[model samples]
Target: MTSTLFRALLAVLVVGLLVGQSDAWRRRRRRRRCPNPTDALSGAQTAWDATFMFECPGAQVIRRIRSAHCNTVEDRVWRFECGTVPGVSRFDEAFWSAWLNEYNGVMNFQCPFNAIVTGFRSEHRGNDRKWKLKCSKVNGMTTFNHAQSNYANEFDLPGDYTVPSGYYLRGMHSFHDGRRGDRRYQYQICLIDLP
Candidate 1:
């Protein structure tokens, strides 16, 4: 009986160890993205993980969403405002303008200089509701910090940003080696727009 118990315990230990190792491996794999095949082999990691959604009165809609995971301390969620457009909050064009417009944000793992993600959504049309979320190293600064957002917008804005209702809910991910100095920093930046 003693010998049998010892064997069962050993098996349990082995399985637990395997499970832990596999979890770590999966996280490592998630930290990688399709950046040029050669570049990936050279040592590439996800700079940031982010998304954007469209907001409206009826229901919260998801616009555009993308994630770039990396070797970080823990998972997080976030939200931000990407500015707004005039005379077209009800239409999709406003959302697209927020995307195509340049000089909006920065690309760094830790934003020491104070950068922000503005997730703008049309709220009651006249309200022109927009919220701004600043990226920080503390923890849980935005909405899309996790796999999903409770305040996700109405729906993804349709493509073709040239027409009257043409709009694009834009989302971007920026990554950097948080493990630079004495302490290695590994994190992702996420953003979700409102309706």
Candidate 2:
């Protein structure tokens, strides 16, 4: 009888151990499925353009962007790196306003799927000017966004412009000034609300 009781206790202990291990496995699986923000940016791909439109391929969100004037030409160039986020299968169709004739105005674009503006690219030539915005669906986010454009000259110090309390930087455009032999900047920022 003692031997039988020992076997039964051993069985109960083994079952408990198995159940605890299964719970741990499930927790690990859940963590693997839900990606952290940094994890979403780990597998990034870079796309650059001088005069053409730059778009992140297929549902990926832009994670970083860099813009500067081209060294050989009197034009601006931009590079954007993008990545995918787990559990976000697809993004809303990107939308942009018609290319305006002037470059220094407020350009606004909205997403139908309630996505937020993640990045932007602007084209500024003599007579042609336009902006393209990249959108991504993030959790605890809202729609109905607006962008404010600020020039470097607007601030006392260059590159010292501060983002508004609830806004974030979305795009940067640089123009080469032949007279100054330097580059000037215009920054586009979008509003965001935190929950």
Candidate 3:
């Protein structure tokens, strides 16, 4: 009777360990399936307002100046652009002005910059509105460059500039701002490249 009881206790112990291990394995799988969104950014001091990062699918190539342009793709739900330069120091003030455009109320850049030197301008035509985000290098300065447009206007814009150390180029755009209105769209450009 004693031997039989001992065998029964051993079986119970084995079954308990298996159940516990199975639960742990399940938790690990779940974590892998849905990783933390910020895990993609290597040097973020603050959390991004939005969750669920869009997969930026693109390839980087080396090319001469004035030879390539950063292009974006627009699907039914999102629009995005991304490009990479061989060196971060390649970007300069002239390159910003020549490559990036500031017309009406939209500013475009061929690659990410270290900062925004000027405030953004917003222009509107009927139901369509455009918000221009300028790039800069100096810190702690707030100024505007464009005149007031007849369209809807917004000034004093701030954004993530000054590329963090040990990072590179990335840009993203999405139409789903997770809002409940017609203005539920967002555009993002950054210089956080992680391995």
Candidate 4:
């Protein structure tokens, strides 16, 4: 009886270990299947003043692009990307907003309701740049709504910027701010809840 009990106990232990390993393998497999952010392409390029970089948040992919030329010296361009998260399906329909301006300080634009900015239209007026954003909705995600600039002064200069993990790039704004023809850039990042 003692020997039989020991064998049964060992069998139970082996089964438990197998189950745990199976669960771990599934989790790893799912992670491997999850997508990675693609290469950052020129969302917008111009002969205006400066060059800057914008990238999608973790595991997100580029989905669209928008560009406009307000004048010879005031043209702007934007690239957009989207990806699947734990509670979100594919980005469905996309919409555009009317031109918006934020004067000399900041031109902050957030997608209304549960939408995210996928593309944009920018107009450089006298001393301000007005923006019209292309917004899109993620099918299953609603835990995030608003996007805000990561820097107070729109990062002041042009360079590379990436959205942190659990967040995505919603919009990008750049304008000729100083007298040296330098450009100031603003990146709007939106945070999402991950499982």
TM-scores for all candidates: the values are 0.20, 0.42, 0.23, 0.46
Q: Write the per-residue lDDT of candidate 4 for residues 41-85, one digit (tens) a residue.
A: 244443232343343444344343433332223333334445555
- Candidate 3, residues 1-195: lDDT per residue as tens digits? 999999999999999999999999998877645223234333322222221222222222111101010111100111123334333332233112332222222343322344422222233233223443334332332222222112111121122232222333222121221122123222233333221
RMSD from true fold, candidate 1: 18.3
Stretches of candidate 3 exceeding 4 Å from the true structure: 35-195
Candidate 1 Cα misplacement greater than 4 A, ranges: 34-195
Instruction: List, residue by residue over 33-127, the lDDT tens digit for candidate 1.
Output: 32442232222212122323433332122233322222232221222213333322333222222322112223222222222222332111111
Question: How many angstroms is residue 91 displaced in model 4 relative to the true structure, after the best TM-score fit?
Answer: 2.3
Against the reference, the lDDT scores of all candidates come to: 0.29, 0.49, 0.30, 0.51
For candidate 3, the lDDT comes to 0.30
Best by TM-score: 4
Whichever of 2 and 4 has more TM-score, that candidate is 4
User: Which prediction has the highest lDDT against the true structure?
Assistant: 4
Task: Mark the 10 consecutive residues where model 1 has the least summed lDDT.
Answer: 156-165
- Put down candidate 2 lDDT per residue, 120-195, tens digits, no spaces: 5556554223566665655565533556555644211223344454454455465444443334555555654433
Question: What local lDDT score does residue 26 receive in model 3, on the 0 to 100 scale?
Answer: 97
The list of candidate 2 runs beyond 4 A from truth reads 1-50, 104-113, 118-124, 127-129, 134-195
